[model samples]
Each structure stands twice: as structure tokens, then as C-alpha cells.
Target: MERVEPMTLFGYEKLQAEVKNLKEVKRPRVVKDIEEALEHGDLKENAEYHAAKENQRIIDSRLAELATFLGCAKIVDPSELDHVKVSFGSTIIMTDVKTDEVFSYTIVGGSESNPDKGLISFGSPLAKQLLGKEEGDEVVIALPNSKKTFEIDEVKYQEIVFECD
Candidate 1:
């Protein structure tokens, strides 16, 4: 059985949008490309046909993946989260014990992790260490390179809003 994973509302909406685009726009475009390529070709040496087929395969794979993801996704409402302890969808601020560098990260599901944007997967080392920890709690996290200590400064849950493109 596939485990149902928690996803923020924004993440769920994003996945839905991607699925729509793939089915509506990309699928037809690839089909057209394949048809046009078929008209020009000897099957064995048709580069355009081969390329279109490969693209179709990729789109089909992604569509299946997205379908599975959406099927098992549970959208988490930020307003329902407890602010006292860190958990999935919690935005946390922590200060490094050694360098005193402070950083903020939103703990999200694995599918929505974007380190560059300060979104960390709930299963990540740092998020795992922070889970169930409260503000002012000190914790140590071991990374691939080194072990670092941090003091939890704050934990809050805020609704994530994604701008439609």
C-alpha cells in the first residue's frame, strides 16, 4: 500500500496545475509532432519521430507519477497546526551555536523540498532534529560533513500561498 503523504495546499495546487498542463497542452503537442514526423520518415532513420516518441514517453511517465502522487496526497491546513512544537509545515527559525548564524526554513514534504528557497523536507536531517522541539530548545544535527548544534528560536505555522503563473 502506498503511504499517504502530507502536502501543503500550495504544493497540492502546484501538482494539479502541472497535471493539467501535461494532459491538455503537452500531450497534444507531442502527438502532433509525432504525426508530422511520421509523414516525413523512413521509420528506422527518423530522428524527429524518435525524439517525439521519447518526449511522449517522458510525458506519460510524469503523468503516471503525478497521478499516484495526487492519489495519496493529503493536503495539510496550516491553521490547524500547533505552534508550540515543530512539525510538518512549520516554519522554524534557528540560530547556529557555533557561528551564531540564524536561518529560517519551512518544513515541507519531500516532494516540495527546495533548499534554495528555505524549504526543507520533513525527513531531512535538520528537520528531523527539529521535529517535536520547542522554541528555546537546543538540538544537535549531524550532517554528511559535520555535526552542528542549533537553538530553536521560533516555530510558527503560516499558510503557503503560491502565485499562479
Candidate 2:
């Protein structure tokens, strides 16, 4: 069975835009470059042709990846889910037990996760640990270096907003 990934509307639209841009703008330009390179000289030792072919390969690979991601995407509206417990699209406010540090995390799709921005994928280790947990529950997350405990202070379902840089 194909795995279905939960994605917010914002995330879905973002990916769609990227795919469209690549298909319409970038891919055509690369194809033209390859065409121009092919006309330059002998195919045996043409550096420009080889480089263009490599670039086309990279673009095709990325397009394939995006296609797969879009095919299995399940758009989920965060506002529709229950906020009483931690789950996909839930925003959690937590406190680190050891250092008393506060952190806020929003569970998002793999394509849109930004750890620095507190947007974590639902499949992430931290989000996995927090799933099914309720507010006031303590969760232990196994980091790469060590395990840290956190108290789930809030499980909220707010509108998921995507910001452009």
C-alpha cells in the first residue's frame, strides 16, 4: 500500500507552485540549453553537452520525487481535528524538563517541515513521541545525542500559516 502523508493546504499549494515553476520555467530552459549544447560540436568530448545532460538528469529526478510526494498527499485542515490530544496538525507548547526551556512545535507534512521554525513533520521523532499524548502529559524524545523529557503544556489546533522567505 502506498503511504499517505498528511499535508496542510498551505503545504500542498507551496509544493504545487514549485512543481509548476519547474515544469514551465526551469525545465524548458534546461531543455533549450541541452539543445544548444548539442549543436556546438562532437558529442564525444563536449563539456557543455555533458553538463546540460547532468542538469537535465537532476531536474528529472527532482520532478519524479515531487510527483510521488504529490500523488500520496492527503490534505488535512488542522482546524477540523480535535485539539484535546496531540496529533497531526496540532501545535504543541512544551517545556523541557531538564532545562525548563519552552518550545512550540506544529506537526506538518514532511515536505514542509522546518525545525528551526518549530514546524515538524508528523513522522519526525519528536512529533512521533508527542502523538496521542494529551496536555500536561510528559513525553521523552530520543535525540541524536541524548534523550530529553518535555511536558506537553498545550495541544492547540490553530490555522496553519505558511510564510514565504
Candidate 3:
């Protein structure tokens, strides 16, 4: 099996908390719902019972997944972040010379990506192109549709806090 790289301590904690919620709150709630449905009679025709059982399966699966991720997690520190250029957890600002469009994105691990909120994964095309680049540098990136060019307007080291809530 491929080894899972370490996540930030905060990220690891979030996984653990989710697992705890699944086991402590969700599982019990599902069990109660199943019992109530079963009391209603005929198991084969009981839609509520079936639905509750399905939900339980999903919750249990997620709990197992989170536990596995936590077991393999390696906490990476902010102090160890690369400062000379764009890297994971670094906020980068860039401009499209062709369109005069300016945008800023923070490079993060795959699990933390939320592009709509401007938090991009390091594995993303933009992040891959931005890595090792300094301010004022121009880079051309190949996209599935076409090629685009960007100029690095600013490069700075920024701390990232992954909050669970």
C-alpha cells in the first residue's frame, strides 16, 4: 500500500474529531432509528429500517477511512515551509498579462483544497507551475483546453491554519 504523507496537526485532529462524532453521536442515533423502524414490524417491507441501515453503513465506512488516515498521518510544521519560492501553504499572487487579470491563491495539500474559496491544492496545475518561481517571473502553463501565461506578482511565506469548524 502507498504510504500516506503526514497532514498538519490541525488536519489530523479534525479527522480524529470526525471519527469521534461518527462513533459517539451518529452511530447511536442510527441504531435508535433502526430499532424504532424494526418495532413497526415486517423487516422486508420496512423502508425506514433499510434507509437507517444504509446510513449506518455509510457512517461506518467514513469512520474507518478517517481512522486509517489518522493512523498514517505525519504532521508537517509551518516553520519547515519553504520561503524562497512558492510551495505548499504559501500564498501566491499572480497576474495574467494577456487579460490583465489578478488573482491570489494559497497552495495547500490535496485534502484541504477548496478552489471556490481560493485555497488550491499543490497538485493543481497552477500550483505545479508556480512552484520554485520567484516574483516577477513569467510562466506558461498548459491546460486541457489551451495554454495560459501568468506573471508572478508577489511571493511570500504565509502561515496556514486548517480549522475543522
Candidate 4:
């Protein structure tokens, strides 16, 4: 089955930018490096040539991966969606019932998710349980090691910031 990738506009644009950079900047530089290395002599012992070829292979691979991601991308803009109920792109604020610790997370695409930055992928365990939950609802999530319960404090739409400030 073909996987449908649900990505925010930011994520999509980021992928596009990476592709552009690889093609326009990185690819040409590697090509030039390889050409220059070719003049240095025998291919059997040319480390520079080998290194440049390896770099070219890596760049090409990344470009192909980016192409697949872009091809399957379904750009989603949270600003246009309703925030009354939990769903993709919703920034959820919750309090851990057991520890009484509060945490906030924004549900995003797999490519956009950075748990350290509070961006959780919609496919994750926590996001799956939070999908249709509303404010004031209690949620129980099954983690790999243990189970944790949380009370939903708020659900709102905020522009996703993929990078840390």
C-alpha cells in the first residue's frame, strides 16, 4: 500500500528547499570536484575522486528521497482548520495526572515532528489518542515502557515552528 504523507506547508516547503539546494548548489559542486579529481591521475588510488563520487551518490540519494516525500505530500494548514476538537496541527496543553506535570505539544506530520521541540507526529501514540479528544477530557496513553494519563487543558491552532528559537 502506498503511504499518504500528511505534511504541513512548512514541512513541504522545507523538503522542496532541500531538494533545490542539493540540485543547484551541492550537485554542481560535487561534479566540479570529481572533474578536478579526475585530473589527479589513476582512478584506483584517487581518494579525492572516490570521495567526490561518494558525495555525489549521497546527494543523489537524498534528492530521490526528497522527491518521494514531495510526491506523496498532502499539505495541511492548521490555521484553516477548526481547533474546538483535537486533530492534526492542534497544539494541545495537558497535565500529567500521575506526576502533576504540565506539557504542551503540537501535532504535526511525521517529517515535521521533533519531540524535543514539542512537535509530535500525528501517527504517534499520543497523537492517535488525542485525535478526537476535546478540552477537559482525560487521556491515557500507552508508551513503550509505561502508561501515562493526562488531562487536556487546551487545544488551539498555532503556527508550527519547526526550528527551535
| Cα TM-score per model | 0.93, 0.94, 0.86, 0.91
lDDT of 4 by residue, 22-114 (tens): 999999999999999999999999999999999999999999888888888889888999999998999999999989899999999887888
Residues 41-126, model 2: lDDT tens digits:
79889998888889889988988999999999999988888989998889999999989999999998999999988999999888
By TM-score, the best candidate is 2
Off by over 4 Å in 4: 162-165
Deviation in Å, model 1, residue 109 alpha carbon: 2.2
Which parts of model 3 have CA positions greater than 4 angstroms off? 161-165
TM-score of 3: 0.86
TM-score winner between candidates 2 and 4? 2
* Runs in model 1 lying further than 4 Å from the true structure: 161-165
Query: Which structure is stronger by TM-score: 3 or 4?
Result: 4
Give the per-residue lDDT digits (tens) of candidate 3, residues 15-86: 777888889999999999999999999999999999999999999889877777777666776458765688
Measured by lDDT, the strongest candidate is: 4
Q: Which stretches of candidate 2 lie over 4 Å from their true place?
A: none
The full ranking of all candidates by lDDT, starting with the best, is 4, 2, 1, 3
> After aligning candidate 4 to the native by TM-score, how far in Å is the CA of 31 from where it should be?
0.9
